[model samples]
Target: MEYDPTLPWYRRLHWQVLSAMILGLGVGWAFGLPAANAIGWIGELFMKLLRMIIVPLVLTSIVSGVASVGGGRAIGRLFGKTMGYYVLSSMLAALTGLLMVNLIRPGQNADMGAAAQQEVPELSTPDSAVDLILDIVPNNFFAAASAGDMLAIIFFCIVFGAAITGLPEKPRVVVTDIFNAFFQAMMALTSGIIKFLPIGVFALITKMVGETGFDRFAALAKYFATIGSGLTIHLFITMPLLLIVLGRIKPLVHFANLREPLLTAFSTSSSGATLPVTIKTLREKVGVSNKVSSFVLPMGATVNMDGTAIFECAGALFIAQVLGVDLTIGQQAIVVLTALLASIGAAAVPSAGVVVIFIVLNAIGLGDNPEAITIVGAMLAIDRPLDMYRTAVNVFSDSCGAAIIARSEGEEGVDTEVRH
Candidate 1:
């Protein structure tokens, strides 16, 4: 675009982000670590605010969406389609990563000496999968909500929504209208918060860069290259092709509508924080029905982490290789299955990916020692960039899912103009 010099400063998200990033980098480099440390607090504050809203927003939106499904059969179909798409897309993303990493052999020459300086901390092993499933049932809803336990929250929302559906029509209408207003209000609030994203992103990026410097990139070059290359291939090749062939939408137009949210997600690195932008872009710009966008985006943000799932599987394999552990074909299959399940269990909370990785490592029998956890710490050091890529994938996957769902609902032709 065009710049309106007369417009207020906050009216321009791009300008704000660019300015913040440049200024933050200058301050970080010139003033050394102290300035960067102070600025980091601002990013943490922004994430805290967004996270504070996620549970309530997800609960309300999901309950409302499920309640809109008029009957049991309708609800069943929607659930089937939503979950089916998540599984397929996530598995494809994981497999794509595996293929690329193996083809490139990015970790073949990894320097264990460089990784020697890293300190591995002892971590408690994760509970079994059965225990993880059992933990989904909240002993106390208030505690679960307060803790932002996503699976429990989702469980509660579905039950609450189903109950609302079973109510009389007049009462159900009022409840639905009330929730509609609630969701709209939350969206508005989210939009207001997003205006501050550039500041948050700048702080987050500058602090990370200042602490690690550029040398860390060299040390983990192979790992980074592997993940980055996989992400690029998926974004440019797999996703666009899928959109064109399966969704029957123009990929160029679809991407144009997605630009703002995708960029915001890249910069901010929190899919939960990016949810407002994703929903707005999907419904207003890409012509996805509100029914589909509302139902899919929130759930996708929580469960459909295609990028992270791929990274977890690929990263695990890399770790196993570096540790000189040869995994059988059956074990590799287990890795794929466990990564898919772990991605769903992984919440959208801050630094939650680290926990998810730990869970994955434990499942693969690497959790007995500090080596696996140290690998994770190394991954965490470069997580900002990886997070950006993954969030984009997450948003892209959600958009495609929304398009497919819209097509299924016969609302694909609702609008042709790009809404961004």
Candidate 2:
């Protein structure tokens, strides 16, 4: 990649986004709600643009890339490894949170009072395991696409891509060429949106800081520390170990390659919004093939969710502790199980984990507790920063999975150099 000689050094995207964050903090701190409201539209536009590209990108990228993987056995092997990694990573993440929160006991010895009744959204938790499985197969592609049903979309794309290989040579070539071209075009468009990302980040951070202020941070310091600590362990420790042990790759080198995607995830606070960046970084910087990245990264965004799993587990435990509810070992096990499943269906957006935390609480039989509602409400106020942190973890985990899978498949694109 070449830089424009005439452009100032600070005009670079990384520097520019960093500068925007600083300025956004100033605006939010000094001007407060008025400025945030004024600049919020750009943030909304930025997210919309990112979301707009996801469906087509995933559809084309997965369909084209999977079509290239070839044959029934190859597809089966790839699918098995991908899902095996996802489930393992997710469960480990949940367990990490469960253990950390139990150890830290952030909500223990706390002086939490009854909060004024806030209207919580009605949660539609998955009815059964069978329902979740059946939901993956969409009744109508158009409806699924419009709804942004990622699982259904992925399911359709896998079947569609697999069928392409069975077609006659002429038709297979034509179809592959078409989807490949479309996927490339979508990526180009995503790159364009990424250019304006700094401004979007500025707007988002400004709005959040301006409206919420920092008071909640002081109030929820322990809970914040607990969540942050768990995320840190998972991102910096557990995930790197996975890469080193299972993938047999250099964890530090892989971490170095993830700079852009991790930073983007933090600023955007939405894995879905940061999907374009994650895909690009994995392919271009980390040296993963489009085949592995296209399949693994998107699925990770929709399903893997290491960060969200941690939050659900920890957050549920925190709320329970605050409510003076001492859950049994079986109930704690239920928390782990529920968190792992709830995270799979979590919306890949900011604070979505907290929104669904009630499901975990409900699973462990604490949903109807009045104090639980109060605790969750208080936690929600301080959720923005945690959301940012966990979103980055979510992206980091996805990138790691892509790198590991690509290595296992013997794709030669990983840049193992650790930049100073």
Candidate 3:
């Protein structure tokens, strides 16, 4: 937690990460896919290490956080606010994407029919909404944790953590202390892993740039522009406004503190993979308390997917445009509703959005079209970069939720003072 005052800025973590990104971009551009593929293992190792800690970190953090609050009412209040914020933010994000895609018309007048010749990636559609609700209660808690089923883990932790509050005082104190200790230990472990972040970012970004090069982007120029512009606006303009206005926080200061996690999220392109870093940064750097961060952040990873919602709505509309199918207003409303629900259930992994996007397509009557399949196949070619952008947005939104919720809970320092 301490820094050497004498160390030059160039040796600092933020500067190091920035330098890694620049160097990675240069190397990837010069060497291309072979270099990217060769060096990818370094990034993968970092991701593995991050993922290794997530389940335990989430379990202990949520348990400890809820127990520390000492009652179900406090935890319930937090949950209500957190979920309300997520729904509102997701609606805005999806609406923004819907509006942007309509204005840009990326698929209008395009000859993307040849996409039919490409093979579509196999994807498993999520079960019915009721089934998704049922799945939140795992058949076995240990199995859910081992499989890293976030929603199931969250449900179990909330129940277990709440139960701890109702125990006799002596046992409640004992149990709470144990979970708190475990959470702290996990944070310490995460801090050690975070030291390798710059190297991991360098490798991951290099591989991404090298493998997909710039030429492919030109082919999907308008599609990329629409999604990219929408994401940028949502992340930089919309979220910051929400923080400053609603949360009473300094958006720039919070953003400065978030650089490490955001970079890691972009590189890994999986919020679940980056959850440890996100929780660590929010608590250590952004000055959010463990109570708020532990509860808000883990839940955010599972359901507060502003970026995925945006991508889902826009991507569905894009495919429709390419196929020359105009959806009615009622149908677009279905896209919005389905996108929100689909994003909540979407796996927090790179390109996972594409897999569930078919739900939106199917809802709008385009799911069975060969032309729709063709466009999806074509879109897959450039999904990685877009995935990275949206993942960063996803992480950023989660952090914002934590900070806001912390402030609402009367936790100070985040809105009034800068941590770093």
What is the alpha-carbon lDDT for the whole of candidate 3?
0.87
Better of 1 and 3 by lDDT: 3
Q: In model 1, how large is the Cα lDDT of residue 19?
A: 74
What's the TM-score of each model vs. the native? 0.88, 0.94, 0.96
lDDT of 2 by residue, 269-324 (tens): 99988888888778767888888888898888989899999999999999888777
How high is the CA lDDT of each candidate model?
A: 0.75, 0.86, 0.87
Name model 2 segments beyond 4 Å from true.
1-11, 114-119, 418-420
- Please give the range of 10 consecutive residues that has the lowest summed lDDT in model 3: 111-120
Q: Rank the candidates by lDDT, best first.
A: 3, 2, 1
User: Which candidate's lDDT is highest?
Assistant: 3
| Candidate 1 local lDDT, 74-156, one digit each (tens) | 77787788898899888888888677667766556677457524333433323677877777688998999997666677777
